[model samples]
Target: MEQTHSRVAVVTGGSGGIGRAVAERLGADGMNVVVAYSGNTERAAEVVKAVEAAGGRAVAGRADVAEPDEVDALFDTAEREFGGVDVVVNTAGIMILKPLVEFDLDDLDRMHRTNIRGTFVVSRAAARRLRSGGALINFSTSVTRLALPTYSAYAASKGAVDALTLVLARELRGRDITVNAVAPGPTATPLFLDGKPQEVVERMAGQAPLERLGTPDDIATAVAFLAGPARWVNGQVVYVNGGIA
Candidate 1:
C-alpha cells in the first residue's frame, strides 16, 4: 500500500451534512481527504476546495456507496491521491419515516441498500486496505434507541448499522484498526429537518438534555476523536446525542 506522512480519510456522503463536516474536520486536522458524494458534483468540489483552503490536500469523487464497483473506485481515489487511507467514514445513508404499518417496502429496501449494504461494502474494503492504526467510523442514529413512532423503518435500518459496527470491530481484531459508530440525535441537518414542522423539530430538540438540535460540527467532533486519537475506543457506539437517549 502506498503511504504518506499525513493520515488520509475517505468520507462517503462527504458533500453535505454530517459527512461534509467530517471531511472538513479531518482535513482541518491535517489529513488528506477524499470527499465522496453520491450526486451533487458541485457541492463535492466545494468541500474539496474547503479542505485545501484549510491547508490539507483533498479530492472529490462521485460514488454510490451501495455499489461495490463505485466504492472500490472511491478507495482507489484515496490511494491514488493521498497514498493510503487511515480512516474510512461511512456517513452515506437515507432515512424515510413512517409507521411500520404504513411504510412502503420499496422505501425500506432503498434505505437498507444505502444504510446497510453500503456500510458493508465500504467496511469490506476498509478491512482489507486500511493501514495499521486506522479507524472505520460508521453512522447510526439515536432513533434506534429512542424508538420514536413513525421512525420504525429508519430506526430498523440503523439498528442494523449498530449491529454491523460492533461485529465488524471484533472481526478486525489484530489489525490494530478500530471500528465504531456515531449515533446522533435530533441533528439540525437537512436530512433531519427536510420535512418536519418547526414545532416537531423543537419538541425533539428539547428531548435532549442539551435542549437544542445538534449541529453538524457537534457530531463531527466526535468522529474526529474516533478517527484520530481514540485508539483505545473500539467496537463501541458513541452516542453524540446530548443525552437524548
Candidate 2:
C-alpha cells in the first residue's frame, strides 16, 4: 500500500480492447500494471508483453472481479509481484441486447453479477486497503443516458455502477482517493460489432456527432486521466462518447 514511489495499477479485463489501452497508458506513465483477465490468458500475456516492449513493467493474472476472494488474490498478487497497488480500473463487463419484455432473467443475473456486483466487490477492496492517493475507476455506458432500445438490462447494470462510484467517493471523503466511472459511447471493438449487420452498425456509428465509432484508445485516455493525476476529480462519471448521447 505504498503510494510514494512509482504506483501500481490493476486493470480488470486488461486483455480486451479498451482495457489493454488503459493498461498501456498507465504503464507509460511509469506505473506498474497488473493485467487481470477472466478468460483470455494468452491475450493478457500479450498485453503484458506489449507493456514491457514499451519499457513498462506489467504482469498478467486471472480473476473474476465479482468474487471477493478472487479480487483479494488479484490485489495480493499485484502487490506481491510489484510493490503495492495505488490504482484500480474496472473494465470487465458484458452486454446483452434484448427488449425489456424479452430480456431473460438469466442474462440479467449474469450481467448484474459481473457489472454491478463485480464493481462493488473490487471497489470495496480498493477503498478499504489501497494506499493513499489511489484511484478507483469504474466503467459505465452511454446507453444509460440515451436510454437506447434493447439496452434495458445493460443500462440498468451501468446505472448501478454509476451510483456506486458516486457513493463510494463520498464514503471515502478523507481518504485522498478518487472514485469515478468512465462511460464510453460507441467503440469499434470486437465485442461491439458481433451479431450486427454492417449497415446497421454503420448507421449506429453515424449517429455520433463524430460520424464514426470511438476507438479503445479514446476511452483509455479518460481512464488514464482519472487514474493518474486527476486527483481533484472524484465521484464523477466522465462520458467519452464523442457527443453521441
Candidate 3:
C-alpha cells in the first residue's frame, strides 16, 4: 500500500528537546511522522501541530521505549495511519551524573534501563518491522569518548549502545536498512543544561572549536542525513560534536 509516496518515521522522545527538533526537521523534509512520547501529551500535541505546520502529516503516540509491547503498538499506529515506517529515530534518554565511586547503583540501573535497554528494545522493533530502505538512528554521547569525571556510568551505558548498533548493522545485512548512532557532544538541550551551572556550561562551550554548544537542530540534521541520504554510511557512530574528540 506504500506506493510511490513519502516515507514515514517514528520519533521517540518526540516531546523532548532533541527529539522535538528532529520531528520538526523530518516533517519539513516531507515525511509523515509519528511522534512517540513517554509522557506529557500536551508537549507531544504541540509537536504534532508544529510538524503539521511544516507541511508534513503527523500524529502522537504514547509509548515507553523500554517497553516492547508499547513500541510495537507505536509501530502499528504508524503503519495504520502514515502508511509504513521508513525511519526510526530513538532519542529518549536519561542522565544522572555522579562520581563512579559514589554513584548509586539505582541510578546506574535507571540510566541503563532507559539508555541501553531502551535502545535494544526499540532497535529490535525497528529491525523486525521497518520496510526495505528504512533506517535506524540511535543516540549516543561524546562523553563515551571524553570520559569525563562523573560520567563513567553514562558513558558505560552508551558504550553498550555503540556495541549493539555496530552488531545490529551487520545483523540486518541484505535488508537495505542503514543502522547508525549519532554521538553528540555538549548539546544545548534542556536535558543537558538542567543541572549544570553557568561556569560549567561556558567551559564546555569553549571546548568546542566552534566556541558554542551544539544545538538540537544540528543533531537533527545529522539524523535526517542518516535517515535519508547517507546510504553507504552505515554501522558507524557519526560524531556531530563540532570537532570535539
- Model 3 residue 118 CA deviation (Å) reads 0.6
TM-score per prediction, in order, is 0.97, 0.97, 0.98
Kindly list the per-residue Cα lDDT of model 2 for residues 1-245, writing each as its tens digit: 44458889999989999999989888888889999999988899999998887667999989998989999998998889987889999999999999999999999999999999999999999988788889999999999999989999999999999999999999997889999999999898887888989998999899998899999999988988898878889889999999998
Query: Candidate 1 lDDT, tens digit per residue, 2-102?
Result: 34479999999999799888988999999999999998999999999988887788999899998989989988998888788899999999989888999
- Please tell me which model should have the higher TM-score, number 2 or number 3: 3
lDDT of 1 at 210: 76
lDDT of 3 at 13: 95
| TM-score sort, best first | 3, 1, 2
Error of 1 at 183 (Å): 0.3
- C-alpha lDDT values of all predictions: 0.91, 0.91, 0.95
Best by lDDT: 3
Whichever of 1 and 3 has more lDDT, that candidate is 3
Per-residue CA lDDT of candidate 3, range 113-183, in tens? 99999999999999999999999999999999899999999999999999999999999988999999999
Q: By descending lDDT, how would the candidates be arranged?
A: 3, 1, 2
User: RMSD to native for every prediction?
Assistant: 1.8, 1.6, 1.5
